[model samples]
Target: MAGEQKRFARFFFYLRNLREAALHTGARAEEAEDRGLELLHSAETEAELKKLEEADSDTLSYVKRGLNRIAFGAVNDAVKLVFDADNMTARDIMGMDLFNVSEIKISGKNVLEIKFFDRQKALEKLGELAPQLDGGGESKRLIESIYGRDGDSL
Candidate 1:
């Protein structure tokens, strides 16, 4: 009887300690979760949101910079196209409303921009230089080849 009582008492003591530890751990976890959520909420800003979106989506800013640098170099080599070198920049095209080369700057940088006037010419230029932005043409061919003649799956 004494041995049994000692065993029960030891079991209760261990159980009580386990329960206390579990409660403290759970409370700490909940507090950490709340702090993480608060940090996420605090990170809400236009610039931060843009960076997050660019990281997730196909912003194509790097592609655009490469294209601009190539074009600028080509222009300097081929023709004496004069430009305010001091004021030369690459910006995003806000909308492709019948503009040859329009710019739209977001967060002091360009995210999505298009430099095109016609379909064939744009395709030609894109095919020659910025093939990544040739989504309309190459994508169509790719989708058609993959999805089949129906084009419904695309």
Candidate 2:
């Protein structure tokens, strides 16, 4: 039926958007697709669109947290600690907050290499989301909380 087709079209639209959101928040390709499919399958009613919108907000928050961790978190000290294997124990390595790290490898000559998520890309994504977050709504409240009513600070 035409109605069913239209509904399915709308569902796919939301799914695509959610998947892009997940990717912008630093999810792997497969992970983003899975999240989108899960969210689409979970919402069976028009009213459930609200839940999808809430999920977008959650994704934005996740992106922001990742950006901050990469930009301001203790990467320098963490890398130093990692390189100083003699001073670091397994428990210390396990306890480290490496949320900003993307990859770790032992390279040629036993060189330890660590890769971090791209901070510039994260900032660019946040810039893209800024206009959406500035629009009046829950996103506006989030912006206000972070940057203040005058849009100063942070």
Candidate 3:
């Protein structure tokens, strides 16, 4: 039982980190890769991450918590459940944060836009997760920023 709880918690943390990273990626295409690295660093165990968020209740919106809770609740006992069953619920998708993020069924691609508070981080995620756009002008700028030509990627 405890293991299940812990897994659920970890799943939520993964969701949070990925969401944060994705949102950051969308927000900062100019410095995409660094933000992607930061997203990697921010990944932590679910319980610790959950506590961290709860501790910062004053900074983030209550709706985020509500969303988190909803997501987490849907994915309890992940270790015991079949892997494909993870996507059967919205909370599962949201809490997991990455499983169906880009592949999410959308009617059109020309007008898809999801904003975030940290643009650079979001940009990094965009580069990492959605690589098709990485060869274009903005991607070139992002690569230049991350590689610094003379600088480096973390």
Give me the candidate number with maximum lDDT: 2
* TM-scores of all candidate predictions against the true structure: 0.19, 0.46, 0.19
Candidate 1 local lDDT, 36-67, one digit each (tens): 33323342322444454455355553444334
| Tens digits of per-residue lDDT for model 2, 80-138 | 65679668888978755576688988889877888888878867876777666444466
lDDT-better candidate, 2 vs 3: 2
**Over 4 Å off, model 2:** 1-59, 136-154
The candidate with the higher TM-score, 2 or 3, is: 2
Off by over 4 Å in 1: 1-61, 72-125, 128-131, 134-154
Pick by TM-score: 1 or 2, better one: 2
lDDT of 1 at 25: 29
TM-score of 1: 0.19
Candidate lDDT scores, in order, read 0.36, 0.58, 0.42
Residue 79 displacement in candidate 2 (angstroms): 1.4
Q: How many residue pairs clash in each candidate?
A: 1, 0, 13
lDDT of 2: 0.58
